[model samples]
Target: MTSIGIVGSQGRMGVALAAAAAEAGHGHCGVDKDGDVGALAKEANVLVDFSSPAALEQTLDACVAQGRPIVIGTTGLEERHHYLIDDAAADIAVLQTGNTSLGVTLLAHLVREAAARLDPAFDIEIVEMHHRMKVDAPSGTALLLGQAAAEGRGIDLGDCSERGRDGVTGARGHGKIGFASLRGGTVAGDHDVIFAGPEEILTLSHRAENRMIFARGAVRAALWLLHQKPGRYTMPQVLGLGEA
Candidate 1:
C-alpha cells in the first residue's frame, strides 16, 4: 500500500482524508503541523496538505527535499504561494486545487466551455457558500470558477476578477467576473456561476453534500501522482478531463 502523510492532520479536511486513506487501504504514515514536515515527507509515499497558508512553505520545502509528490487542497493561498508551487514542481510532482470534488472539477470544465461560447455581452458572476468555519471569503471554489471563466475569455483572472463589493460599489463592469460569498451553518459547499445576457441568463452550479467526495478525489490524485513526472497538475489532468 502507498504510504500517505497528512499535513494539518487535525483539521476537518485532514480528518476526512485520513479516514478515506484508511478505507483505501493505504498506509497512514504520519500527520504533521509545527513539528517535522520533512520527516513525514521522507517517510510517506505522498503528502496530502489541507493545511493553512502559514504552513505551505514548510510543506513544500519538505516535499522538495524528500522528492515526494503532494496533493495540496489548501485554500486561501496568495500569488506568491502559487509561484512557490510552480517553482517546486520543477523538482517534484505537485497537484493543487481549491476544491477536490470530482464533480467540481467537471463543473469547472463546463464553466470554461460555456464562457468560451458566450460573448462579452454575457456578464459572469460566481457565488459560493460554505460552512461558517471556513476562513476564506469568496471561497476558493468560487475563484476556481472565475479562473475558468477568465481562461475561456482569454483574459487574466487577477485583472478581471471583481471580488466582494461593499457600499458605494458602482455598476458591474462589462466582461468582468464577480464573486459573492456566504457563510453559515454546516453547509459543505455550494457554488453557482451565472452568465447574464440581455434577456437570457444561464447558470451552472455544483453542490457538495459531504466532505467524502473531496477526500476520495484527493486520494485518487495522490495515487495518480505517485507515477507522474515532476510537474504541476490540476484535478482535471488527474481525471483525464484536460481537453475542452
Candidate 2:
C-alpha cells in the first residue's frame, strides 16, 4: 500500500482528498496550517499539496529535502514558483497543476485543438464558475484553458488574453481570448470554451458535480508521479496522453 500525506487538511479539497485516500485503502496523514509537513513527509511515499500559495514554497522544500514526489494543486502561483517547480523536478518528481479534474484537462486539449482548427476571425471566450470561497478570479483552470488556446495559435497568453471585463467594454478584438468568472454557493466547478463566428458558434463545457473528481485525479497523479523519474509532469502523462 502506498502511504500518502495531504497538506491543507482543513480545507474543502483537503477533506475530500483524505476521504478519497481512505476509500482507496491507502493510509493517509493530514496536515493543517500549523501541522508539521516535514514530519509527515518522513512517513509517506507521496505527498499531495493543496495548501495556499503563501505556504507552497516551504511545503515543496520539505518534500524536496526528503526526495519525496509531490502532486501540487495550489493555484495563484507566480513565475518564481514555476521556476522552483522546474528546479525541484531535477531532484524529485513534481506534478503541479491549477486544476485536477481529468475532464478539465481533456477539455484544455480539445479547446486547443479547436482553436487551432477554427479561423482566427472566430472569437474565443472561456468562462468558469466556482464556489465563493475561491480567492482567484478567472480561475487557474480558466487561465489554463486560455493558455491552451493561446498556445494553439502560437501566441503568448499574456499578450492575447483579456480577463474580467466589466461595464461598457468596447467591441471585442480579433484573436483576443476573453475570460469571465462567476462565484456562488457550493458550486463545484464549471468551465466552457466558446468559439463564435459570424455563421456558427461552438461550445465545449465540463461541469464537475463534486470535489471528488479532482481528488481522484490528484490521487492518481500522485501515484503516477511516485513511479516516474525526476522531471516535470502533468495529468496528460498520468493519463497516458503523453504516449499518444
Candidate 3:
C-alpha cells in the first residue's frame, strides 16, 4: 500500500483527502497548519498538499528533503512557486494543478481544441462559481480554462485577458478572453466556457457535485506519480488525457 502524507489536514480539502485515502485503503498521515510536515514526510512515499500558498513552500521543502514525491492541489500560487517546483522536479516527481477534477482537466483540453479550431470572430468567455468561503476571485479553475483558451488562440493570457469587469464596460474587444466569477452557498464548483459569434453560440460546462471529485483525483495522481520520472506533471497526465 502507498503511504500518503497530507498537509493542511485541518482544512476542508485536506480532511476530504484524508477520508478518501482511508476509503481507498491507503496508509495516511495528516499534518495541520502547525504540524511538522518534515517529520510526516519521512513516513510517507508521497505528500498531497491542499494548504495555502504560505505553507506550500515549507511542505515542498520537507518533501524534497525526504526525497518524497508530491501532488499539490493548492491555489493562489505565484509564478515563483512554479519555478521552485520546476527546480525541485529535477530530483523528485511533482504534480500540481489549480483544480484536480478529471472532468475539468478534460474540459480544459477540449476548450483548447475548440479555441484553436474556431474563428477569431468567436468571443470566448469563461465563468466559474464556487462556495462563498472561497477567498480567491475568478477561481483558479477559471484561470486554467482561460489560459487554455489563450493557448489555443496562440496568444499570451496576460496580453489578452480581461478579468472582473465592472460597470460601463464597453463592447468586448477582439481576441480578448473574458472571465466572470460567482460566489454562493455550498456550491462545490461550476465552470462554463462560452464561445459567442454573430449568429450562434457554443458552450462547454462542468459542474462538480462534491469535493470528493477533487480528493479522488489527487489520490489517483499520487498513485500515478509513483511510477513516473522525476519531473513536473499535470492533471491531464495523471488522468492520461495527454502528454504533460
Candidate 4:
C-alpha cells in the first residue's frame, strides 16, 4: 500500500482525500497551512495537494526535495503556477488537473472528438455550476472543456473564449467558446457543453453528486505517478484517455 501525503489536510477535499486513501488501503499523513510539508513529504511515498494556489510552491519544493511524485488537484491556478509546476516536474513526477473525476476526463475526450467532427457553425458554449462557496467563475472544468473544444477546432482557447456577457453585448461571435457559471447551495459540480448548429442542438454533460469521485480519481492518479519518470502529467495520461 502506498503511503500518501495530503497537503491540505484541513479542507473539505483534504478530508475526502484521507477517506479515499484509507479506502485504497494506503497509509497517509497530512499537513495544513504553515505545517511542515517537508516532513510530510518525507513520510509519504507520494503526495496529493488540494490546497490553495499560495500553498503550491512549498508543496512542490518539498516533494522535489524528497523525490516524491505529487498529484495537484488545486484549482484557480494562474499561468505563473503552471510555470512553477513545469519547473518542479523536471525533478519529480507531477500530475496536475482542473478536475480529477474520471468521468470528467472522459467527457473532455468526447467533447474533443465531437468538436472535431462538428461544423464550425456549431457554436460551442460551456456551462458549469458548483457550491456557493466556490470562488472561481466558470469553474476549471469548464475551462478544461473549452480547451478541449478549442484543440479540436484548431484554435487557441484564450483567443476564442467568451465569458461574462452583460447587457448590450452583441450577437455571439462565430467559433467563440462561451462559458456560464452558476453558484448555489452545495452543488457538488455540474457541467454541460452545448454545440448549437442549424436546426439542431447537441449537449454533452456530467454531474458530480459527491466529492468522493474526485478523491478516488486522485488516488488512482497518485498511484500512477509513483512509477512515472520526473515529468509533468495530466489526468488523461494517468487514465490512458489521451488520443494515441
Q: Best TM-score goes to which candidate?
A: 4
Model 4 TM-score relative to the real fold: 0.98
- Which order, best to worst by TM-score? 4, 3, 2, 1
lDDT of 2 at 231: 86
lDDT of 2 at 227: 91
Against the true structure, whose lDDT is highest? 4
- Single out the weakest 10-residue window by summed lDDT for candidate 4: 235-244
lDDT of 2 by residue, 1-244 (tens): 9888999988999999998888888888879898998997888899999988888888888888898999999998889998988888899999988788899888888888998898898899998999988888888899888988988888898989887678998988778999999999989999989999889999999999999999989998888888989988887778777721
Candidate 3, after superposition: displacement of residue 105 in Å?
1.0
Q: Each candidate: what lDDT? A: 0.91, 0.88, 0.90, 0.94
Q: TM-scores of the models, in the given order?
A: 0.96, 0.96, 0.97, 0.98
Positional deviation of residue 134's Cα in model 1 after best superposition, in angstroms: 1.1
lDDT of candidate 3 over 58-136, digit per residue (tens): 8888888888999998888899998888888988899988888889999999999999999999999998999999998
Per-residue C-alpha lDDT of model 1 across residues 1-244, encoded as one tens digit per residue: 8999999888788888989999999977656567688889988999999988889998999999999999999999998999999999999999999888999999999999999999899999998999899888988889888999999999999888898699998998878999989999999999999999999999999989999999999999999999999999999998898742
Clashing pairs in 2: none
lDDT of 4 by residue, 117-159 (tens): 9999999999999999999988988998999999999999999
